[model samples]
Target chain A: MNDFIRNLASDLLRLEINTIIKQNMSAEKIPSNKRVLLRKLADMYRETLIDYGIAKSADDPQLTAADAPKVLRWQFGGEFSFKEIALMASKGIEQLEQAIKNETDPLRLNVLNSRQKILQRICNQSYNVIGIFKLFRRDLAPDTLMQSNEHEEPAKQIHYVDKEHFNYLRYQRGELPLECIPFRSHQETAHWNNDLDWMHLNAADDLPFLPDMLAMIYKAYQIGTEQIVLQTVIQVEGDITSYITPQYINMPDNIKEVVMNVHNRAISLSTQFWNTLFSTVMNLAGKSFNQIFTRNRK
Target chain B: MTLHSIALLWKKTVNWTFVPVKGLQFARSLLKNGGHVVETSFVFGKASFTFKTVISFGDIVVFIPDPAGYYAQHQWHDLCQNPHWHACYQKYLQIHFEEIANYFHAIERQIAFWQNSISGFIGIVNIYPLYRALLLGEWFLLFFPIASALYIRFLGKVTARAIALQLWQIAKKWFIPKAALIAKILPKAG
Candidate 1:
């Protein structure tokens, strides 16, 4: 079961990376400096995933200033910039080339796939930093009132179940596993930090990175909803009367609004691209469930 | 997931990030992650900050923290480190003499909540640490999601254990023979 989820995690990461790569490629052809920046972003993604234990590779050549793809190749050959040559190369060429040369070990594949996903997150973070810098250029300055005394109001009480029935538990008291919380939170945190690093690079406020950052968030949301549905399906397939059954999952209406918001933002990215990705995700989800059903029958 | 699970996870996640830190560290941690801080002043004692939206001074503090990091200051702090009965009475901040004055502040923090399960309404409740001592059973019972359903299960276990320990407490209590037998039977049935 752990292996199943871990494999799914890798697949999900690859899918996420592919989506980001597709979107960026669609938005505009890679420019010289931007291509260098993208490779750097990819390197950052690779190193981060390795450190997190999500990816496992002892040696993937380090990216250095002078050792850049173009800089090293230029001395021996042509005068073309690295970005121009990269632009001329087919989409997903670098990742595909690496995938082909690498050994087909499940662990290695998982590592590369996870790196692919992390690169997507890095790109999203960069986009957010750039967007915020562009959008809130004026508000980038630090405000005078750094700290103040207005606290958040308590959440409004919603009467779905009585307080007597639906009692909340604190973490210390619960004997549940930490994996109960979605892995998406960690992914989001990683992406946010990546964006912060980019903001540091540009010496700009993190606020400008809002738009694309929001898009990445939307993509994650879409993936998360799909995950919940998949898990629910698996649980239901196991047993109809399990305590955490699909029938028991009463998703609130507000949650639906959040999903819609993510879908809407995704559409805003590029309608055609969003549609294609959405369809691909749905198809994969369908295939996953189909495999489960066939396995159960067997 | 059930409402109980959702609320439990929400409460835990907030506390996981917010409870530790003070002054600049708290402020930087919040803002660096796109969260803001609320400065709460008290009429007396030392000052403290908790999470994205909680500040504490004397008893008279401000409102609870919100999801968005819009921090607003609610009251002024009385900078008396020592508890002086004369000082609170002398300084007329409020109409009545309350033991403490805690202010509320709102700080705006940006969190991209991807889950459809997360509603903007985060319930804030006043928790008294003192109750933790007296109501050990109640506190223990309260910390389970779907407590109503789990409470019965907990009681069944407690009863079974009590039955096994029936003669165990006999030496301390010095109960009669019939009464001891009844105590053992009653727990087993439960």
Candidate 2:
């Protein structure tokens, strides 16, 4: 997964760089000074790729600034890319600032100032896009590559259950996972566990991230409910198996009947509970929704 | 494709459509109630300039001259027309500019914090199903798109309104006094 992510990032970066080069080359009649600036920018990109281990030193000879534009144009075709435009706009601001400083005429100064303001707006928007991209890249970074901050605490370990088990337990409780999971801090945990109880008590005092808190509650419920059900099944199975032996079978017929009847009753009640669970949940949800809607209407 | 997959695809289509609808609603709320407009008038000799500054909940500040105001229209042409008044106004603006910028920066930081929180919530809702589908092989999550769409449709408006109201309250409490101070400091011209 890490390799796949890294490769995807590298491919995207290469594509972006190629598009930028192609776009720059396709522009009609670039001034000599602007050409020099583009070359310099290309060099900067090359160095950045090398620093990030996306490009190797051996590839430098084939991928020089002079060769990049032609290769990129042939491969990706000539198209405008947003990052390239933003980069040029930023550089244009620098030139505009210099012109504004050098000009003595008030009218020209006003024009230059307006142009600079417009360019500044574009640059600000570009910065926002760049910031979002940076955030995305950081999220995609492999765990090993991610820098750890001393002040930041390590994330808490979360428990998860298989879908089948989660569904079974939820069915037994006569609730949808959505309904079972508490949306607000004030709501009680669906299933009782010491850790969840403590967490719920403290939830109001110290605000944790909402999704994490809910996930923890859900998982704890699933695990707790599954354990209780499995334990009950095991105990029932043990009792039935113990009675199946010859010595146990030889016991008083009345006592044996009573024991079997008690076991049968427990099994019948469990079966009935599971059968009614879905309908019960639906009815409860309908009632709640109706109440909310009626109250709103009033 | 199977009926199940087709149903899932339709849900996803509805979800994608709903996202932009909710986005537009949120934008409308933000525009309506998430900011305060501050107007200040500056008198300089024979010329007076009225500046209207709109400070948005997103911490964007826009300053514009009042195009319709009598003093602003007749007295102050473009600042370029009278360099002396322009220079004086510039000097005055320079003095308070840093403070205003800092105030907006603080507001921006607060907005960014809230943006992170909102995005975090969205990330969980959108990504959780994918994680389950890919890692746990949970085919039942085909309904996730519709579920999330329903979640957003029902809850998105309430959240947007609440946030907008909160922003309005904050702007009223914090920005009004600061704007009033700036208006009070406007030196009379002449």
Candidate 3:
């Protein structure tokens, strides 16, 4: 069963990769050779940056002492070393630069430039991984080891600070690592950043429905809130009914009469609304089916 | 019974019950983690003008037209007609371009995850009954190997439709107006 699930996930991932390739092809109309190269480069980057899990772990705040050594080992001796990945990315950037230099069409140039930018980002990330790993090693180094050495004095025990303090230290020292800067910039300028380089590239055409979809999500939240209110009302009504049931048995006749009347009125109103809603839904469904059949016949 | 037989029985029992439950738990976790992305895609596809009309006609007739096509069309029209609004809209898209791309990538990942997980679950469930039938020599049961297939498919469709409708309602109430506001507030291309 485990094997089956694994196979299924791999198959799905393969299908997704194909779909992305197709979408890029349709959207960009890149030459076949360049397309294949781009696809290969993308796959390589995805494997190194995403599939390896080290990059993500590097960003993890809760990384423990035990995991740090294992992660370091993976980074240095993993299937593709970070240096090799960085070299490949630089090679990819060189190719993209050559393409951009030769390409006459502004549109294709834009696409190539975007790809180059992405490759550059990957290259930077690869280099950052080494620095991040070094930091991890320094944090996790043992004080006892220094004391045991005959030539060395015992160093002060440095406790590992969380990500925030680490950033503060970097700031105090006037050292802004590439990884630290992007996240900080993102937080600071999240609301307003006018970078129109993507506009000429027609990047928005790739996902035209985005703005609308975002708007729809906002709308959905409002509707969902209202639905919750309606649902709560129904729930409260049910609770009232349940609560009144036991109390009704012990109540005096007049009080029972008043409670019954009120309960019946509430139930009647709710049922009426529900019945109308049900009927309207059925009507609409029937109409839609009829329209579909009629259109098919025509 | 011998200890070995007891162990074998235990293994079989766990495989029969525990494995599927774990698979379900995994699928549920995947959905819980990544469902919003998939839901957004679903909303984009199913929230057509016709769907909106039908829904609004049923309820209070909120009359929120489909925004996917509508927004794109209007943005183009606005860009053509007015230079100022065009500038603002371009800036808007550029400002949010990374975010939009991130969303697109996430949606794709969620879609791939969902398709594979659902197909995998269905395939496993279907295979289990056949395996059982073959092991027990239950020949009649072999005829109903995929008995639950149609039922599961129907349930999936119904759930998807229900979720889309609920999302549509919310989109109409909040997103449509916000989109309109953005359009209104941006300087016209005078």
Candidate 4:
């Protein structure tokens, strides 16, 4: 418990310091060289978040320095720029500091407390995509130590059944196995890590790479499907026909929508090719059966 | 040759052949190179009408049954033309549909079998981890397509049964009378 609280406090402190440095450098007065150093540190921190798989959905690989002026915001939706946030944070911090200076007036004390509360809420709103980075290494290496958390069921579940179907489709197409993906939760082992690294990635405010990143993800559909199919085939049992049956499966509306989105993206690259392949296989089968019947009569 | 001569030769060719009726409860077929011969039987008034179906899958010609065979023979076209036989014919078609549903169910069983086998193997691989390393080595990726293809071919066999059943139903109208054919086979009594 103490570890969790301490870890959380440290994380908030780091975020605050990052925000303050940015504010002091641009909106306020700080040396140009010092500003460059602060920017580098901030970029490094963001890179670390991306590596940890805790980065916001919109994050992308940073462009070259030639790409326009630098802009950082606390949240994707937050209207204020990093400089604006710095200015706000600076004022808030100073209010608390000023209240400490007097150290006597009850009204000042109330103001300090209220100011802190406001900053905390703003922080939560800006960077609050929180909790756990689930890792299931296929290697199941002993070094991959994870802590289990029992509670909290995500509202939308990604069932192995769906993957089984997806993977089966891949398998039928003579595709290779899928690569393993790390997720944000593992209910069975309840093992997880929300350390500062994961926390930073998850709480990313601006995801500039959303469109490009999603395109890359979609591009993997052809190959990744093979893996999903192979993995599912390896994991699931029964209803093998329906496992990758050509027919559309009925799913809950929410899940169906998600599947449609992924499927729609891959249709251009995959649908016709697969359809032709399956039909060819089926037609060959039909002919084989046909030959068996006709050739024996004579 | 005419259909009549063809039917006569078909009947003569199959008369000498007999197969044990055991272990073939669901079906009795003689799969031959180039084609197959399916056996069917029924009783009419103490005389059993047993026939060998010379099936030409390529030709879509089920068999050339004896054209003079009374219950079937020329009786089939008449039966179809018969209004009384409508209900019976429809009922027989209904039976075909039921069997199709059953075929799909059997396919479900086939899928379950594969899943259980694969999962069991995977479970072992997971627990031992060392086995996974050996089993999941570089060339291991090749096994998936082979396994899946084998599965498809096996499904092909299952589907063959279904397709054969459908053909059998169509050919049945000839041997089994609408009033007489339906009564002759799928025998209700000894």
Across A84-162, the per-residue lDDT of candidate 4 in tens digits comes to 2334444455555666677787666654554454444333322321211111221232354442222213333223212
lDDT (Cα, 0-100) at A72 in candidate 4: 25
Per-candidate fnat, comma-separated: 0.00, 0.00, 0.00, 0.00
Q: Give the CAPRI rating of model 3.
A: incorrect
lDDT of 3 by residue, A128-236 (tens): 5434323333444434223342211223112112234454355356553322311111111111111112222222122111112222222222132110101112321
Residues B19-108 of candidate 2: C-alpha lDDT, one tens digit per residue: 544433332222222323333456665545543323322122223222223345444245335567546655544433433343334334
Please report how far candidate 2 places residue A240 from its true position, in Å: 82
Predictions in order: lDDT: 0.29, 0.36, 0.35, 0.30
Q: Which tens-of-lDDT digit does each residue in A1-298 have in candidate 1? A: 2432243233332211111101001112122232234334334434443454333222223322222222111100001111222232222335544674775876666545544544454444434433433333335333412422121122322221112211112112453222111111111112122222233334422222321233332232222111111111011123322112131133334333332332233223222322332344455456556645875799
What's the TM-score of each model vs. the native? 0.20, 0.21, 0.20, 0.16
Clashing pairs in 3: A219-B170, A219-B171, A219-B174, A219-B175, A220-B170, A220-B171, B82-B189, B83-B189, B84-B189
Provide the lDDT at A258 for model 2.
Answer: 34
List chain A TM-scores, every candidate, in order. Answer: 0.24, 0.23, 0.24, 0.18
Cα-based lDDT at residue B4, candidate 2 = 100
Error of 3 at B95 (Å): 20
lDDT of 1 at A157: 21
